[model samples]
Target: MFCASVEQMKSIDRRAITQYGIPGVVLMENAGRGVVTVIEKSFAVGRGAEVLVVCGVGNNGGDGMVVCRHLLRRGASPRCFLVGKKSRMKGDAKTNLHILEKCGIDVVEIEDRIPRQFTRSLGRSVLVVDALFGTGFRGKLKGCALEVVERINRSRLPVVSIDCPSGLNVDTGCVDGSCVEATATVTMCVPKVGLVFYPGRRWVGELWVVDIGVPEQAIAEEGMLTSLLESHDIHMPPRDPAGHKTTFGWVAIVAGSSGLTGAGAMASLACLRCGAGMATLCLPESLNAALEAKLTEVMTYPLPETDAKTLSLNALELMAPVLKKADVVAVGPGLSTHPETEQLVRSLIEKVDLPMVVDADGLNALSGKLRILRRRKAATILTPHPGEMARLTKMGVPEIMANKPGVATRFAGENRVTTVLKGAPTIIASPKGEVLINSTGSSALATAGSGDVLTGVIAGLLAQGLSSTDAAATGVFLHGLAGDIMAERRTEYGVIATDLLESIPEAIELVLGSERGFFEGGVRRVL
Candidate 1:
């Protein structure tokens, strides 16, 4: 399913009208009707409820006008509050305001010295429709609008936002000014990218992609595709019965040291959980005993170790033999940054000839030396969080977080390495120069040994013969989904890395199973 931004959706909407001959007014009417229909169904207090419709002087305000009219039809008295002077509104918004005035809906011109007074007077309204700003807003809110949102928070009324919450960046999930805290949002046509990620999602609440008669073909014709992977998107047709284990491919992981043995174990387990046909963890000799007991299903090979228990240069010969037979190579989990250990990392990276996913200290070892990956024989995917990405890109963590999608796409294209920038809304940047944002995983996945597990999952996918793009995209999603399930089973703060490792099966089941969250609460329809 396509997850679009306000700008992208607007382009589609415009093309549908201009080229396809659908009038703008008719589209607006359909959009407004969809919002009202969702509101009538979702809001419990209706009919005689006192609904407060807060509208700005824009097309978004126009949507609020339509909502007010529909509420009136439903036998509710809606108190309409127009934020600015009537003369400020234009286009379809002006038309709706005129219709609202003639219909005798009391449109109050709020003369509060500060807009905070307006929200205080709203007193326990059954609903507050936030149509303050729409997609056309290019920056943060200010003055009266900011004041209005703050008091709305204080009023404690359930907010129903039309289109989008006021101050969210639709493309990036970055938050700037005061945003609406809606109980539910009626997103006409497709879901916004912002609603699926954090900070923006923190404000969007429960999202309803209310269809407004926009055909899928029309959206596709405009070439505005935001790839969102539901279970159906990841579903591949069933394989032939004759297919065997080798058909899935093989993955080798070069990871772990004495104290960091847990990282390699977690990753190797993820490889099997994610459906790798053959998976092996090759680690330093000294730690194999503890790791062998910790992990039984995964095959382990012990190599020469240093005094500090990190992999020594002598281990490279042993790793070379394994790398020759492996389809994917996952390196750099729990391999501490000792100089000799970093040298071992550099040698293996330069010589290995398999698809690679380098993560954690593996990333730290190659921090300023990305030129090494440019020399590899097979495909490469770097799974780096913003902190690691900052080290790779020579920028601060704040800068990387602010414009993640843009940075990931540009960097991956430039470096010729598939890059997965990990965090909320994890981004997968392909060597082909395309970027995808993943919506899986919970904040609960922010525990120890998580990155190591991700390295294993991606390696496992690569071993299964998936393209680097598909592996990174699917791996990030699956990793996050596992985190979400584990977090639900154990609260977000309580779920550990091992819990994420354990819940991979549950996440796969939820995706493949019959549960699809639709109308009503809690998504329990078995189909």
Candidate 2:
């Protein structure tokens, strides 16, 4: 589904109201009702539970006002706290405030100081509805509003924020200052970009996207390119029952050295686990014994090795014939950055005609010579962490991380290759400007050798007739899902790369066997 920025969301809302003829008040009513539904189902609020609705003077506040009316109808007593002066509310918000008063619901307008009664109300409430800000908000909260937000957070009551957490920057996912730590957020129309990205993600606990009468045509007309990858987005082709081993693609992995043989073995094993029909690990001849002993299912090809026990330039000839039989080539896991090895990597990159997933030291070898990516004939996928992407783009790590989607998209567009910028909320960008923000993964994936498993998963998918874009997108999602599964079974701190690899089948099963999509806490019926 498309993840919208503040401007995109505003444009979509405006278009829906103006051209599509959907009333703004009706939209606000839908948003409010949807939030109340989530509250009723998730929190189980009823007559005995009191809801404290903290609202601002904006439309987001209007939505909160509507929520108060809905809660009253549902046999719940909702205390509405208006942070600013009552007269400050205008338009739909003003209308809703009047409607709340007409319904005999209590509306506490806090102008200068927070009333002691409001604090008591917060203490007695079962849930806090935070409708202080919307997507358009920026900067820090100050004055009475700041006090109210801080007090609400300290109250330890479960908060359900409307649209977004009050202090989050919707576009960049940055928190300038004090932001509401919501227990759940009911975003309207579609999920905002910030909620899925980090920093802001920490504050947006459980997320639910609600339909607020915004026409699908209006959102589609905005031409939003960025999207959050959900389980429904994954599409894997069915295997032919009559087909043999050769029916699925063959993957040739050029990785590892004497000491880094484990990296190559992991990548090769991940390929087979991801459904690649055949996988061959081509590494330094000296590491064959160790790799062969470690990997039983994957075939091993010993290449010419240098004195340092890394693949030498002479191995390129042997790899050329191997590439001719392979459907895809994955290079650069565990390969040391020795001068000769770097040279060999550069040569193989330019010479290999097969679709490739280049990662690890392979990215390091191409640091200054990124022009070689533009010269490749077949599809080239560069899987880089922030440090590697920084080296490739000649920018600092912080800069690359701050604007990962932009950096990955720009690099992919300029180099004419697919770019999988690896990090939390991993970004997969196609040369055509299509970008997918992965919605799976956890801190457990921070462990070593995890990226090698990812590289192998992408290569395995590529070998199975997936395009570079689809392969990378699918691989990253499955890799993260595997990590998530591992994190659940074993604690996040204890999860290793092998654990992630072991869970790949279960992850694939979860993706294929189930019809649900990802939510904040776990898989739920798609909203």
Candidate 3:
């Protein structure tokens, strides 16, 4: 599904209203009705339940007015609490608030401060509808608005935030000060960016992106985009029965060190698990035995190793013969970020002709030298969490996490490389200005070596002949699906990177099950 940022939605709204001649208030009514439909499906406003509709002085609260009217019509004695005074409400909100008075539903207007006992009365309320702010809000909540959010949060009440949870940066996904902790957030039109990233994600319990009768072409015109990749936006890898192992492709991985052989092992294993026809690991002669003992499916080549058990200058010379055949190259995963290693990484990045998936120490090698991304002959996919992304982009982790999709999309397009900014809602950006978000994975993936596994997954996909964009997008999706399965079998905290890998086959089977006939041939699994 496509996700449009707030700015795009506004432009589209203007186009529909001014150009197409659709009344703005009519569209708002459609949006409010959609929210009611969603709320009805997810929750039950118990018989005579005290429903509190907390509204601000805006169009979003006008939506709350519609909710109150619907509930009162349902025989529920609901109370309407206008956050601002009656004099402040205008336009449609004023019309709806006045209509509430006519309908005999009491409208209690809070002047300057929210009474201490106001939200406390929420002890008996089954639900609280949050209509404080909309997607246009940039910064944070404050004063009475801020206090009301805190009070509602302290009450442990089930809140249903309209459009988006109040006080979230709709474009960047940042929550500056305070936001409503909603039981579920009902997003109108396309989902805002804040619903997917960290702190905003924390406030929004469950997310449902509802359409409000807007045409798909609206986004096509504005050109603003959000990265929320769904299943349809991907290209599946082709499987030909007439092909040999070489037809799929080969991956040459440069990883492993004296004490860090495990990183290499995980990377190689991930490539094999991701369906690579072959994964060749070029390691220093000293670390060969250890890596060999740890990996089975991956072929190993001995390169020059220094006395320190790391890649030497001679190793770069030896890689000349094998680099020509590799479809994908993995530079660093556990190879320590030493000065000598940085030189080796820079040389390989410049020399390698195949697409590269750089991770861990490989990313560290180029922290201060990000311009190296522009000098690459082949496609480059950099997988970095907020911290590593911060180092590469020269921005803080907070900044990267807040505007992750923007940062990743900007850097990837600027440097002509694909970037996978890893986090909740992992963003995959291609240089062509296309962005895809992975809406999968579990918190259990927060453990060590998980990134090595991820690097492997993407490399393996690249080796299996997927495009740089498809490989990165598919790799992150499958990686997260594996984590989700692992989390289901073993709780979030119990799932490790190895557990993530172990769950891949089942995840693949589950996904492949969706497109059964092609993969299953003439037969089918009864289950």
Question: What CA root-mean-square deviation does each model show from the true structure?
Answer: 3.3, 2.1, 5.0
Residue 473, candidate 3: Cα error in Å is: 1.6
lDDT of 2 by residue, 1-527 (tens): 88898999999989998998988889988889888888876897878579999999999999999999999999988999998888898988898999999999878888889899898999899999999988888888899888988998898989999989898988888998889999998898888888888878899988888877687789999998899888878867568899887788899999998778889989999998999999999999888988889899999999998899999988998887678899999999999998888999999899888899999999999999988989998999999999999889899998887888899999999999999999888999999999999989989999999999999999999999999999999999999999989898888999999888899999898889756453333112222
Residue-level lDDT of model 1, residues 1-527, one tens digit each, is: 56787778888788777777887666667767777777766678656888888898988898889888878888887888887888998888899999988999877765444544355548858788998887666577777787888877778888988878878777776668678887887777777777776777888877776655566678988564346555545542234478776677678888887777889888888988877777788988988888788878888899998899898999998776777778888999999998889999888888877788999989898988889887776899999999999998899998887777778888887778899999887888886666676767767878899988889988888888788888888788788888888777778989888887788877767667734444342111111
The C-alpha lDDT values of all candidates are 0.79, 0.89, 0.79
Q: Candidate 3: where are CA atoms >4 Å away?
A: 98-102, 113-121, 138-143, 368-371, 510-527
Counting clashing residue pairs in each candidate, in order, gives 1, 0, 2
The TM-scores of all predictions, comma-separated, are: 0.91, 0.97, 0.90
* Candidate 2 ranges with C-alpha deviation above 4 Å: 516-527
Cα lDDT tens digits for candidate 3, 1-527: 56677777788888877877777767776666666666666778766888888888888888888778878777776778877877887887778878878998777776688764465557778788888788888776878888888878888878888878888887766788888888888777666666776767788887765555566676567775555655444455777889877777788889988888878888888888877888899887988887777777889988887778888767888888778788789879888876787789888887777789999889888888877789887879999888888888789887776577789999899888889988887899999888887877868889989999999989988888788998999888888889988898888989989887798777667666553122121111110
Model 2 clashing-pair count: 0
**What is the full ranking by TM-score, best candidate first?**
2, 1, 3
